[model samples]
Target: MKAWEIQESFGISHLVQVERPDPTPGPYEVVVKMTAMSLNYRDLMMVTGRYNPRQPLPLVPLSDGVGEVISVGAEVTQVQPGDRVAGCFFEHWTCGKPSREALKSSQGGPADGMLMTHKIIHENGVVHVPAYLSDEEAATLPCAAVTAWNALFTEGNLRPGETVLCLGTGGVSVFAAQLALAVGARPIVTSSSDEKLTKLQALGISAGDCINYRNTPDWEESVLSLTDGVGVDHILEVGGAGTLEKSLACVRFGGNIYQIGILAGVTKDMSVIPILRNRVRVQGIYVGDRQSFDAMNAGIAQTKIQPVIDRVFDFEEAPEAFTHIEAAAHVGKICIRV
Candidate 1:
């Protein structure tokens, strides 16, 4: 089997194609023929050696993938041959409390990921993709969509008629905006590009009001203005350290802020006075567990929410897909056909 591997902990350029023996499933595992995989910001961090330092060398490089079951091992009955399935990002986190052990387990790290021609996944970690979605669409659900789902519903408890603020037009933000709308909550999406905002409007998203963050660096005030000085009910914070303060400013008193990503520089400092004054709850979100993933898939089936895919690359163009994401040029999911 051909898989993309990071030859060394250098950068994206270090990613190289390598041949590995095709894997056979253990008694509780199933082997899948990968159809598609999607990229996430963490993948970039892993490539650059900026994520967890414990990540092993020569690691397989993606956590989100969808495939069809080709063969099953002895005790595997969760899925059979020909069933479409997507592997969980946190392979060991089936449900309940996430411990350090579960957090350490993931595909595309010391554990093999699905960026190859075939992947073997433990039956417990594989979830059936929504019947309505194609392989390309289903591939985007594992990490990005699940993270958005956890951020909005699990952490924020966003309600209908409440206003939610999503920063940037990344995969998580886009999915969060759509989910908010599906639940009757209003979404305010910010972008550096006006053109993208127009496209979002065409998709029936009012966007509350679009702010060109590049133009107005203090866009938090704009969010305040839109909320009639009350601030938004929830904020999906993707910018991490760089945007945390502004996110605090834009959230309403007693509101929740889901901190999901750190696309900007990592280290940050903030005064606790604002959080104390507003009584805000800040929650850090991992991708989520199987139950949450299943709930998100159900919502996708019910609403038929289409993911915004910026581009698709051939299997051979996987490196280019990574490059596109690293450049921050894509508006939504960047997929690779395998």
Candidate 2:
């Protein structure tokens, strides 16, 4: 088997594609023959040693991938050989409240992740991919999509006819838009690139729903104006501290704010007065548990939604994938065909 390993010296240049002995699954484990993998901002942080400088070296990178079950352990009964599936972002968190043990099982960080030719996964840690999505599309789901679903459906209790604000056109934001549309909720997307906003518009988002954050730095006003000054029912807060205050402004009184990323700056000086005065709710959304992933897949299967992929790189171009994500030029998901 071949895998991309993040060497001791971090950065994309240190990512080496190397050979490894084929893995044999333990009891209750399954062997996945990876067909496609997707990149995330966290992957870039890991590669650059920005998130955890002391993260163990020579680690397999990337947590999102869709593969076929090539073999299963004797006790594995959840999936059979040839079933297409994607690894759960958390190998141990099945459902409900997460614990330290469950959180520790997450890939692309504390644990070895996807991004290899053949990887071992716990039988319960992989789910059947939606039939509507191709391998490339399914490869984008394990982290970003699940996190979006957790923020909206699981935590926000989002309803149709409600307005939602998407912070950017990254993977999670795009997935939020897709899921919002699937449930008949309206999505307003913001992007610095007018071209990226156009991509969202092409996907059935209303012409007036796209906002160019670069042109209008105070874009929260645009969101409020769109809602007739009531503000949106929910805001997907992927921008972190840099935009948290703006998000607090854009959300309606008592509306939910799903904190999913820190793309803008990890730490910022901000007041909590708005949250207190408006009676707003802010929920931190991690990539969800297996139960959430299953529910999301069921909804996606029903809606027949296909995740938007900005580009796909060949397996050999893994290093370039990291570079591409670091550039932040893509409108949606960037995948690698394994």
Candidate 3:
């Protein structure tokens, strides 16, 4: 089997293609032949040494991909040889709360990930993709989609007619918007690019609901104005310390702020007074578990929500995929055909 690895260094330029022996399934294991893979911002950070500078070297770095089961151990019953599946972000996190042990099982960093021609996953770590989705679409589910799902449904407990503030046009944000629409909730999206904001209409965002952050630096005011000074009920806060202050200002009293990303620097001087004064709930969301993934798939199957793909790169152009994501020009998910 062939795979891409971060060989003895951390950068897109350091990624090298190499050959590895095909893996065979052990008891309760499944071997999948990867068909398509998707890029997450975390993947870019891991490669560039920003996510975890201490992460081990020579690692296959991606948590999202879809493949056909080519083999299964005798004890495996969850999936068969011909079933299409996507690997879980945390191989051992099947249900319930996360723990230190479960966190260690995360792929693409401490564990070897799904950036190869074939991968061996525990039978419990793979979930069947929705029948309606294409392989490329299914590949985008493991991380970003599940994170958005966990934030809105599992943590936020979002109700219909409530307003959701999506930080950007990234995968998780877009997924949240689609999910919000599916549940009869309203979503207001923000992007630095007006073109991207215009493109969001295809996903059901209205021209008035989209905010160009570049033009409106204090976009939190816009959010409050749109909601008639009550503020949004939920916020997908991806900008980390850089935007958390603004998020605090715009979220309604007792609203939920699901912190999922740190795209805009990890550290900054900020006050915690607003959090207490507003009685807001700030939760840190790390993807999700298999139970949540299953629930999300069920919802997707029902809603027939198609994942937005900005571009698809050939297997040989894997490095270019990283480059494209770093440029941040995409409004949706970026994929690679394996």
- Scored by CA lDDT, what does every candidate get? 0.87, 0.92, 0.94
Model 3 residue runs over 4 Å out of place are none
Q: For every model shown, what is its TM-score relative to the native structure?
A: 0.97, 0.99, 0.99
Model 1 misplaced regions, further than 4 Å? none
Total clashes for model 1: 0
Worst 10 residues of 1 by lDDT: 199-208
Worst 10 residues of 3 by lDDT: 198-207
Give the Cα RMSD of candidate 3: 0.7
Against the true structure, whose lDDT is highest? 3
Residue lDDT tens for model 2, 16-110: 99999999999999999999999999999988999889998889999899999999999988899999999999999999998989999988887
Alpha-carbon RMSD of each model? 1.2, 0.8, 0.7
Select the stronger candidate by TM-score from 1 and 2: 2
Q: Candidate 3: which pairs clash?
A: none
Q: How accurate is candidate 3 locally (lDDT)?
A: 0.94
lDDT value, candidate 1, whole model:
0.87
- The Cα RMSD in angstroms, rounded to one decimal, for candidate 2 relative to the true structure is 0.8
